[model samples]
Target: MAAIAQERYEDSYLYRLRHSAAHLMAQALTELYPGIKLAIGPPIENGFYYDVDSPVVIREEDLAKIEARMKELSKLDQRIVRMEAPDREAAKKLILEETTLGQGPEVAEYKLLLLEAVPDGETISFYDQQRTDREGKFHRFLDLCRGPHVDSTKEIKHFKLMNLAGAYWRGDAKNKQLTRIYGTAFETKEELETHLHNLEEARKRDHRILGRELGLFMFSPRVGPGLPLWLPKGAVLRDTMVTFLKEEQLKRGYEPVVTPSIASIKLYEKSGHIIAYRDKMFPFMEDEERETYILKPMNCPFHIEIYASQMRSYRDLPVRYAEFGTVHRYEQSGEVTGILRARGFTQDDAHLFVTKDQLIDEFIGVVDLMKTVLDKLGLKDFRARVGTKDPLSDKYVGHDENWVAATEAIEKACQTMGVDYFVSPGDAAFYGPKLDLIIKDALGRDWQMGTVQVDYNLPERFELEYIGEDSKPHRPIMIHRAPFGSLERMIGLLTEQYAGAFPLWLAPVQIAILPIADRHAEYAAELKVRFRDEFKLRVHLDDRRETLGKKIRDTQMQKVPYMVIIGDRDIEQGTVGVRSREEGDLGAMSLDAFIERVKSEL
Candidate 1:
C-alpha cells in the first residue's frame, strides 16, 4: 500500500518535470561551461540537484546566470528523447562521443565511471536533447541517464536555481569535490512562488539562527563541532521535557537507571556495535591496564547488561530500564547542524525485556506513551514509518527467523493499535526492524523524531533468558524505545515549530513581570515570588532601569507567554496589568483573577 502511494508520486508528471528540469539545468551548464563534467542529477523530495565537475568555479552569483540560461533553454522546445545502448562498449562510445558534446574525452570522466559501476544485466540508457535554432545554428545536449523525462523542454518551465554546495564525488572524501547546484520546479508559477516563499520562511525559522537569538544553545569551535552548550533557558526547557517524560515512564512501569558515559570496548564488541556502528563511534581510548573504552553511542547495551545481571522467572518477564543517557557520535562536520544533528546529545532511552507473549502489549504501551509525549509537545502532525532490513544488505545480524519474527511483531502491534505507517526498506537498525515517528513541523518539513524497535537479535546475542512455566530457559524479546529521540534535536524542532513562542507549560519563562517605575519594583518582586513559589510557574522579574515600553518589547521579543505590569494605580488597587503573547493587553485584573487565568492556560 505504501509502495503504491510512493509510486503515485514517482509516476506523476511533477516527478518527470523535475527530472527533466535537471536535464535542462545540465544542458545550461554545458552551454555555459563547455568542459563541465556532469556526474549525477536527480529530482529529490522538494527539488532537484545536479553534481558536476565544472571547469570554472561556480558561485552564488553564478546561479542567476545559470538560471537565465536555463530559462532560455527551457523555452527552446527541444525534444527530450531517451535512447538505450546495446552493450557496455556502445554505452562508453556514446558517452565519449555524444555526452561529451565534442568538448573532449576528459569531460566524460564521471559519466564513464558511472557506466562502469552499472550492473551487467541493467540496460545502458541516455537522455538526448537536440535542436536547431531559428538562425540555423545547431545546439544539442546528451548525457548518460536512465530517464523518465518530459517529452519536451517546454515543460521544464517555472523553475528556479536555489543555491550552490560542494559535494564529494560518489560521496567519498578521497574523491574530487563536485559543485552541487540545487533547484526547485513546480507545475505552475503560483506553486513555484509559494515554494520560494516557504524557503524564505524556513530561513527565518532556522534553529541555528533562532537557537542563538532565543538563547537556547550555542556551538563553540573549541568545544568541537556538533557539541552544543545549552544556555540557562535551553537547560530549563530540557529539564521540563525530562521531568514530563520521567513521570510518564514511571506511570507506565519503567524503572530509572544510570550508566557510565564510557564503557569497555569489549561490551560493544559483544553487542556487535563495534562492527556495525564502528564508523559513527568516537575513537577508542586505552587505559593503563591496556583496556579499551569508547564513549557511549547507544544506551541499549548497558540496559541489556543490567537485565542480564538479574536472574528472573516468567513472572518477572518484562523488565524496563529507562535513562536520559548522554551519548556521542562522530558526525562529520558537514553533516552536523547545530543541535538538530549534534554529536553529543541525551536520548530519552529505554529498553524493555519481555516474553514473546508480552511483546504486543508492551509495544502498544510504548506507542501510546509516544503519542502522549507528542501531544504535550504540541507536535500533532506526524506519521509512523516501519523500517525493515533490505533483503540484499549484509549490514544486519541474527538469523532469518529472528528477523522475520521481529518484523512481524512490530507490524502486528501497529495493526492492533490502528496506527498508520509506511514501510521503508534499508532503514532498519543493524539489530532489528523499527517504527519511527516522522513529524512535520510548522514549516511542513519532516523530522524523524520518536522511535521504537523490536529486537529479537540483541537478546539472542546477549543470551538473555527467563524461566518458562516448565522451568526451561527461553529467549526474551527486547523493545528499544526513545520517544523524544534526543533532547537537543527535539528542542531544535520545537524552537522552529513554535518559532520560539513556546506554549504556557513548555515555555522556559511562563510569565515576565515588568515594573512601571522604581516604586513598582517592590510590588513586581513580590508578584514574581508568588508566581514562582506559590504557583510554581517559571516567572521572570524585569526590574531593569529601562522604559516600560522597552521592557514590554524586550519581553515580547523573548517570546514569553505572559507579562504583568505593576504600576502605582495597580499597586494601589491590588491589581496588575496583564499582557498575553498572542493577544494585546488586558485591563487591570485582581491578583486572584490573573492567577486563575494563568492556571487555566497551563
Candidate 2:
C-alpha cells in the first residue's frame, strides 16, 4: 500500500488536488442540498467526480449554484486535517454522531459501505476542513478518505465543474443508477485555462463532425452502432495508410499473409482469449454440422497457427508474418465512440517467432520500426507502457520464470533504446507482458496507438518449437507487434491530430486540377493524365461549371494538398499556377518544377 501511494505521488500532482477537491465538493453538496445521499467520489485523469442519489433531480441551472458554494468554501482557506479511526465500528459511530447533530443518515450509510469493503489491517482515514471565527471555533465537515491532501483549501484555487451523467453504482449494470458529476482541476490557473482550451479544440476536431463536413465516413443505424461506412474519400485515405505501412513492413523482411474473418471457436479456446475475453467476444454461430465459429476478435491465434504450419529450424529463428487483419469485438453500447473505439477494425499486425537468444534484439528491431512509422506519420509525442504480469491473478499462463524473463527482456529493450516508459502491472495479456505506446494528439489528449507484446505462454500453449543447432527441440519466443494498432482508430486519431489537414503523401486527393474556364479544360485534363502516369499522383480534373473561386473552396474543404489552376496566361506560357494547403499561391511554374517539389515532399 505504501509503494502504491509512492508510485501515485511520483506520477501525478493533480491527483492529490483532485482527490481533495472531491471531499470539498461532497461537503458543499451536502450543505446546499441537505437530503442528497452520497455514493462514491474518485479522482480521474483530469479531475474528480462524485456520485449522488437524491430525490430532487439535478438540473443544469443547479450546477452554478453548487459551483458558487464550492468557491465560497475554497475561499475560507480552511485547513484540511486528516484523521485515522481505530476500526470500522469507530468509523460508523463517528458518522452516526455527526448525523444526530444535523448531518443526514446518508453519511452514516456511506461510511458503513466503506467499512464493509476495506480490507483487514488497512487504516481507515478521514479528512476534515476546519474553520474558526473571532467569537468561537466553527464546526468541521468531514468525509471518509484515503488521502494525501494539500494542507489547506487555498491550494485548490483552480477548478471547474464540467458535466453530469448517469452512472451505475460500482460500474455494474445491475446496480442502482446514480447521478455522477464530472469536473476538472489543475495546480495553477494557467494550466486550467490551457486544459479548457484544449477541450474546445478537441470539440472542433471531433471525427464525427469532421467526417460529416468532409464526407469522409459515416455510421448508419441500420448497419450497427460501432461499424462505420467509409466514403470514397475516406477509403482513399485508409488505403493510403495501409499501403504505406505495408511498404515499410516489406522493407523489414515481413511477409504479408491473409486470413479468414471468422474461425472455429476451438481455435480461440486454444489461444486462451476465449477464457479471458469471453465477455468482450461476440456470440458464436453454428454451421450445419453444429460446429461453432466466431468472428475473430484478435489475429494472434491465427498468426500462431500459421507459424506452426511449417517445421522451422534455428536458421529460421525470427519469422515475421504481417497482415492487415480485420477483427470484431462486442463493445457495449455506452462504450462505443466513433472510429476510435469500434466493433470492427483492421489491425496492421505482425508476429515474430524467434529463439530465446534473439528475443532482446528482435524486440529492439520492433521498437526501431515503430519509431520509423510514427516519425513518418508525424506522431512525435508518445510514451511506452511496459505492461507486466499480475502476481495475484491466475488469468495469465506460463511458468513464473518465463514471465520474469519476458518482462525483463521488454524492460531491457526500453533501456537500451533510451525511451521513456512506465510499468503497468495487471495490464498485460493473460499470456505475457507487452509494451503499449500512448500518444497525445494536437489537443493534448492522450490516445493509445501502438502495442508490442512478448509472449511465452502462447508458444507453450500451442507447443510451438524449433530445432536448435544441437538438434534438440526448444521452445520459441513470440513477439506480437502492431505499430498503427488499427487502421480505423489510427485514421480517426490522425484526422483529429492534423485537424483534417493530412500530409501531402497521405491526403486522399494529392492534387486537384482546377480550370479557370472551359478553354483550359483540355490542358487540365492533359496535365492530370501526365501527373497520374508519370508522378503516380492522385490527380482530379475539376470540369464543373462552378467558378474558379468556388472550385478552390470546394477542394480546400476536401483538404486537398495542392491545387493547379490553369488559365489563359498559363495555357499560353506552358506553365500552371500552384497553390498549397499550407502555403498560399506559388506563381506559375513549369510542370517539371511542380513534380520535383512534390517528389521532395514524398
Candidate 3:
C-alpha cells in the first residue's frame, strides 16, 4: 500500500507543476542575469532547484526580485513544448543557439557537458517555453531537460522562491561551485501558505538550536565539526535512553557485549566494506609494526569475529550480541548537520545468528522490538521501507539467489507483522536487504530511524556454521537490528519532535523545586532529596536568592515536566504547590500525591 502511494506521488499533478516551476525559475534567472551558465534543474521531494553560474552574485535578498520575474513569466501564458534532437551534434547546436539566446557558446558549458553524459541511442530532448506578445514581439526560453511539464506556465501561479545555497557542480568538491536557487510550487494557495508556515515552525524546532538552549549538547571547533560533546544534562538524557533500551533488550533475551574502537583493516576487507564503504571511512592508520588499522565504521564485523570464535550445535544457533558501540565515518564537511549526521556516534547495534528455519521468527521478533522502541519514544506516525539492491548496480556483494531470499524474508516478516511498507530500490546496504523505519515528526517531516537487515553473505564470508537436525554443518543467516539507529541521532530527532519538552519519563530533569525565598531553601532541598532517593525521579532544587515569580519563570524556561513550589503555607500545611509544564499551576497537593501523579505518568 505504501509503495503504491509513493508511486502515485511520482506521477501526481503536483510533480509536474513543480517541474514546470523549475523551468519558469530558470527562464527568470536568464532574463535577469545575462550570460549566466545554466546547469541542471530538477524537481525534488518538496520543491525544485536550479543550479547556475551567474555572472553576478546571487544572495538571499535577491530571491524576491527573482520571484517577481517568475510571476510575470507565469502570467504570460507561455506554451511549454518539448522538442527532440536527431543526434548528439544536433542537440549541441540547438543548445548553443536556442538555449543561449545569442549569448556566446561559452554560456552553454554545463549544458554541453550534460549532453555528452547521456548514453548513446537515448532520446535527447529540451523544453521550450515560448510566447508571442500582442505588440508583435516574440520571446522563448529553451533549456536542455527531459521534462514532463505542465502545458503552460500560467498554471504555475502558486509558487515561492525559497532560498539560495552553494552547490558544487555535479556534487563534486573539486568541481566549480554554483549558486542553487530553491523554490516550491503547489496546486493551491493554501498549500503553499501551509508549507511556508511549516518551514517557520521547523526553524524554531531545529535541534541544534534547542540542544544549546536546553543544555543537551555542543560542538567545538577544537574537537571537530561533526563531533558533539555531551553536556551534563545531555549525558543524563543519553544514560536514560540507554537504560531503557538495555532493560528492554534483556527482557527479549539479548546479551550485552562490548567491542574496541579500532580494528585490523583486514576485517573490513573480508566483510566487503573496503570495496563498498571505503569512501565513508577515515584514513587508514599504521603502527610501528606496519600493521594497518581503521576506526571502525561498523560493529557487525566485530560481532562476526566473536561468533566465528566458537563452534556450536543447533541449541546455540540463534546467538544474539548487543552493543552500544561507538563508530566513526568521514562525512563531508558540508553534509554534517549537528548530531543528526555526526562523524562519531554510538549505534544501539545488535546481531542475531540464526538457522535458516529460525529466520522468519527472529526477523519478526526484531520488527516487534523496533515497534516498541518507536512507541516509547512517542513516534507514532511511521512507515517501513524495504531497501533492496538495484539490479543495475555492481556494488552489491551477495549472489542473486541470496539477495532474493533475503529480500523475500523481509517482505514476509512485514506481512506477518502487518507493517505498511514501500519497496525502495538502490537503498539497500551492499550486503543485504533491510527494513527501515521512516518516522514522521510533529512538523510532518520524515526521518529514517530504526533498521533491521537480513544477511546471508556475511556468514558465508566468515564461514559461520552450526550443526543442524541432520547432524550436518550448515551456514547460518545473520540479522542486524538497531532500534534507535544511533543515540546521537535519536536524541536529536526527539529534541526536535517534542521541541525540547520531553515527556516525564524521558526528560533529563523530571521535576524542579523552586523555593520562594531563602527561608524556604532548606525545605526545597529536603524535597529534592526525597524525590531523588524515595521516588527515584530526577529533580533539581533552585535555592538561589530570587523572587518567587523569577524562580518559577526560570524553572518553566528549562521545560521541566513538573515544578514544586516551597512557601510558608505549603511548609506549614505539609503540602506542595505543583505546576505543570503544559497546564498552569495546581494550587496545592500532598507530596505523596504528587509522587503518585509522576509515577502514573512514567
Top-TM-score candidate index? 3
Which one wins on lDDT? 3
User: Candidate 3: where is the Cα deviation over 4 Å?
Assistant: 1-4, 8-10, 102-106, 116-122, 172-176, 392-402
TM-score for each predicted model, relative to the true structure: 0.93, 0.92, 0.94
Compose the digit string of candidate 3's lDDT tens values, residues 10-97.
Answer: 6889999999999999999999999989998999999999999999999899999999999999999999999999789899989988
**Tens-place lDDT digits, model 1, residues 366-469:** 98899899989999888888899998999787778777877777777677666667778888988788999999988778999999998877888899989999
lDDT per residue as tens, model 2, 336-439: 99988999888999999999889888888898888888889999988788888777899787788878888888878777776678888899988789999889
Ranking by lDDT: 3, 1, 2
lDDT of 1 at 501: 89
What overall lDDT, based on C-alpha atoms, would model 2 receive against the true structure? 0.86
Give the range where candidate 3 is weakest over 10 consecutive residues by summed lDDT: 1-10
Positional deviation of 554 in candidate 2, in angstroms? 2.6
Q: In model 3, what are the clashing residue pairs, if there are any?
A: none
- lDDT, model 2, position 590: 89
Question: In terms of TM-score, which candidate is stronger, 1 or 2?
Answer: 1
- lDDT of model 2 at residue 541? 90
Query: Model 2 residue 52 lDDT?
Result: 86
The whole-model lDDT of each prediction reads 0.89, 0.86, 0.91
